[model samples]
Target: MSAEDATQGLGIDALLERERAKLDRLTPARAAAAVELQGALLVDIRYAALRERDGLIPGALVVERNELEWRMDPTGDHRAAETTDHDRLVVVVCNEGYASSLAARSLHALGLHRATDVIGGFQAWAAAGLPVTGAPNAPDGRA
Candidate 1:
């Protein structure tokens, strides 16, 4: 079926809900712990504009949304060094968590079964007092 036909009646909200249902989404704090304690790879999928404007999560792999599958597929030639195994946990983060759900679902389709997203994305991470760089009054107390 055509892409339009497959999504004939489903709006973005419905599609996001369906995608999220397949994931065990993580909150900002939990996501941070997963990275710090469990070796989970936190991937920032927000575009360059957003990253520049809102700052970034320190140590999170900055992968463009369009390049995610290529960079994240463990067996792909272009895969990031961190994409070493299918069993590795990958936590996706977007601007506000919406796109991350869909991105995580796509990772699942690529056999990354442990892929999931941050519940409120980078905004939540920053709000939860997690580390961020380049943001106003950053975690390090930098302006």
Candidate 2:
């Protein structure tokens, strides 16, 4: 096998756990409260396809995963308007919870001290009955 194949030795599961180990992730409800009460910025880093299929959380900024570090770096020109304050709490959400952990960690590296991820990601947020736009089941927030 080539070097690429060997790189998989750690496995995605182990890699995910490693990333999660460095994060202080928030629960879906807590994340919602943070956005509502503490002025936290919620970032949805799922791909466009996933967002199109599963819908989105209302008010959450949709930034793709690959562009997170740049778009969220307070000092970067590419940073979003909400990223101007490094002290702001940032909660990142992925399809599940894995990629969000890594994304939050990247934000931390960018001096975003309060960056974090939703524990169970978008699914949990919807399950918790938080308001979402588009296809995320209305009223009940089931899907």
Candidate 3:
């Protein structure tokens, strides 16, 4: 935690609250429906090990959390082909959902007004009976 901050030197929880406050996060079921009906782009930002161990959402784009902003920034040289639209509804996913909120906020900074994160992440999706493929070391999802 940093000292002398405006937030009274609060830690990650406070940071998470601030980030989430800026978003309209979606539940897993709604997130899946958003992709199918609202044209939302679901992004999975988990690392290789966790993803391989748990599995992946069927159609979510695999982009590591660290490079998210660059890949989704339309003006960036390495931006993903699917992220060209500033109005695209981006739904970022992390292992449990915390990091995805931060990722979505970064996307908003790049003029992506429709950016948001999954409420409970991949686990929630699986719990909600959403489609997922690949298993631990299954050699199916992106490495």
Top candidate, metric lDDT: 1
Q: What is the lDDT of every predicted structure here?
A: 0.91, 0.87, 0.86
Clash pairs detected, candidate 1: none
Once fitted onto the true fold, the runs of candidate 3 whose alpha carbons sit more than 4 angstroms away are 1-4, 136-143
Specify the poorest-scoring 10-residue window by lDDT in model 1.
134-143
Regions of model 1 farther than 4 Å from truth: 1-7, 136-143
**Least well predicted 10-residue stretch by lDDT in candidate 2:** 134-143
- Better structure of 1 and 3 per TM-score: 1
Better of 1 and 2 by lDDT: 1
- Write one digit per residue (lDDT tens) for candidate 3, span 30-107: 898899999899999999988878888887899999889889998889999988789989999998899899889989
Compose the digit string of candidate 1's lDDT tens values, residues 1-143. 36885869678887788789989999999999999999999999999988887788989999999999999999999999989999999999999899999999999999999999999998888788788889755557322
- State each candidate's clash count: 0, 0, 0
Q: Output the lDDT of residue 99, model 1.
A: 90
